[model samples]
Target: MAARPIGLRWKLSAAIALVSALVALALSLLVHNAARASMLDSSRDAQDERLEFALRAYDSGGQLVFDARLDDPTLPEPLRRAVVKGKRATYVEERGDGPPLVWAASQVGDQVMSLNGRFADRDRALRRMDQVLRVGSVLVVLSGTALGILIGGQLSRRLRKAAVAARELAGGATEVRVQEAIGRPARDETDELARAVDALADALRKRLEAERRVTADIAHELRTPVTGLVTAAELLPPGRPTELVRNRAQLLRTLIEDVLEVARLDGAAERADEQEVALGEFVRRRVERLDPEAAVEVTREARVRTDPRRLERILGNLLSNARRHGSPPIEVTVQGAVLRIRDHGPGFPQTLLSDGPSRFRTGTTDRARGHGLGLTIAAGQARVLGARLSFRNAQGGGAEAIVWLPAQAETDDGTPGPGSPGPA
Candidate 1:
């Protein structure tokens, strides 16, 4: 059979209880010994006083000897034996007779006299003391054990709470918390453990969020080209197959190229040329290249240190997302080191706003139109470029995303020049 494992709480409690019991037992024994010694000394003193009075009576002679009673009720039976055998002393005790007292003979002023009752009643008294000590020690040890167990149990309970919380945390339950008793401050080991667990959970949550964003972006970017290729292939006529095939083949090539661009943005074996670029000029050039029908706006000029290709992909994806999700009249703003992209469409869906963005979460409900990769790719690129990106509904009924780039220097031409590239 396998041996059962003992818990930490039980181990600690048992250790405390055992130590307490041992100490209590040792103390009880020491006290018992001291009390016994004191009682024995008092018994001996009383016996000696009785013997002294008897000696005086015997020495008085005549009527004094007849009046003197050797067996005094004040002295126990075992102590009375001190008078017998005269000059010889013996240690003997009987039940209910107390302990034996020491007796001896000594000469004073050329007279012979008997000395009796020195250490009287000690044996019986000692026996009674031993019994009492044994009983008292038992009681004291029992009481101490009980008290120790109670204290140890309470301590174990608190420690167990922390242990349970630790286990839950290890198992990935980041939100698990210890329940505090009434009027108790939440500043114990359990609370500390809970805090550490919460920190880990928060970090894990952030990492998962980043990963979901990457996955969604990849899916979204792939969906657009895939859809285009599928549509082009479907449109090919069965008759005059060669001509239809040629058009389909051209559409496939365009789809591949677009997909490759998105892939590069996703860090698919392509490295960015890290360089300082003027933010105002970069944004202007990108806007100029966009579909003329899409009304674009630029509000401020700010320089940011970033990779040129990465920055372009970031801008391109944002623009693509805006075009796909929003109306034609798009507004773009750059103020300080922040960039704002706003769309006049129906704004963000309530679900998206609440859930935030994920891999392949597109604005349009059209399942066949595009995969929701644009925002994911843009967000990923922004992260790689050491920038922050966020999306929300504008106050005046439109979807807006704000991007905060690293601070940059203003050029002589009023355009922003790169200061330093921040960490990815």
Candidate 2:
């Protein structure tokens, strides 16, 4: 037969109740015994005082006299006999006109009383105390058991919430939260466990985001150059000269370089060398280098701590994307550790605006020209550098990208001046 599994709460509560019952039982027994002994001693003391009073009365009057009445109403019915020097003495009292009474008296003036009534009374009282103690012990045990069960139930409920939260997290519900209504504080084990589960879910979400971005970036980088190469090849004359073929090949090589750069950015293959770069200067330089004829403008002065090469790649990709998909006249501005890039292009598609960033989203642009990985890579790069990136359509018909860098590299004046370097 299989053994039944006991729950922790029940086991703990049972153990506590058992211990409490044992202690209460022992204490009740001790109290009952003490009470019984005290009652017996009191009965004997009252009998002795009565005998002494009778002896004094008989000695003082010199007439064999005794009081047949007891001072205590609780005294039991018993024969009082007095014998002097082994001879029993007869006594007559005015209080009782019935038959004479005799008792054996000891040499030391001790009198012996024999009766079942006193013993019976003591026995009855002891029995009553025993019943009361038994009832009280039972009440104590039950109350303790109830208290233990209540505490155990509360703890079990909290632990169950944590377990359910863990299961939900494992099932890919990153937003699941454990209920904290059990009164356990945040520093307690249950709360700590809930926090750990939440952290795991957040980590999984970030990892998934990174993976999706990488995949989209790869497809976008590959499609652009391949399409260009195919188009150039088809346009070549049937009997093209070697010079024409060489020019087309050079174009293919440039396209390959561009593709390789995008690939490197996605793969994080660039080396990290720390540098202090002025954000304003870097943005202006990148805009000039990439698209001098595109009517690009720069504003604001900010400094950043980063690896120069990686930062350039991040900005370069953003600029290239805007030039390809946007309507031109790009605006780049930096303030403090924040950089804003806006293009006077057809703003993001309604779907993308609503959904935010998604995998392989082209944002209302032609598929052949824009594969939608550029923003994804830029976002990933920003994340790698501990920055937050956000996208939104400008009030005027255009799209705007904002990157907020880490606080450590910002100027004390809350502005990034020209002459700061790239991300480290």
TM-score of decoy 1: 0.42
Per-residue lDDT tens digits of candidate 2, residues 1-424?
Answer: 9999877689778988899899988999899879866865665555455556655665587433334332223222232323333432222221254211222232224533221113456667788888988898888888888888887887788887788777866644555766443345746677777777677777877886577477557756766776776667667667657457656565555555444445555554444565788777777777688777544443455567876676776777777777777877877776666777778988767786676555356765466665466666676666566566777889978887777776455454664343322331
Estimate, for each residue in 325-354, the C-alpha lDDT of model 1 and write its tens digit. Answer: 787678776554566778888888877677
lDDT of model 2 at position 399 = 82
* Residue range with the least summed lDDT across 10 consecutive positions in model 2: 99-108
Pairing residues by index, what is the TM-score of model 2? 0.43
What are the runs in model 1 whose C-alpha is more than 4 Å off? 1-270, 291-300, 350-356, 407-424
Candidates in order have lDDT scores of 0.60, 0.62
Error (Å) of candidate 2 at residue 375 is 1.0
| Cα-based lDDT at residue 97, candidate 1 | 54
Task: Give the C-alpha lDDT of model 1.
Answer: 0.60
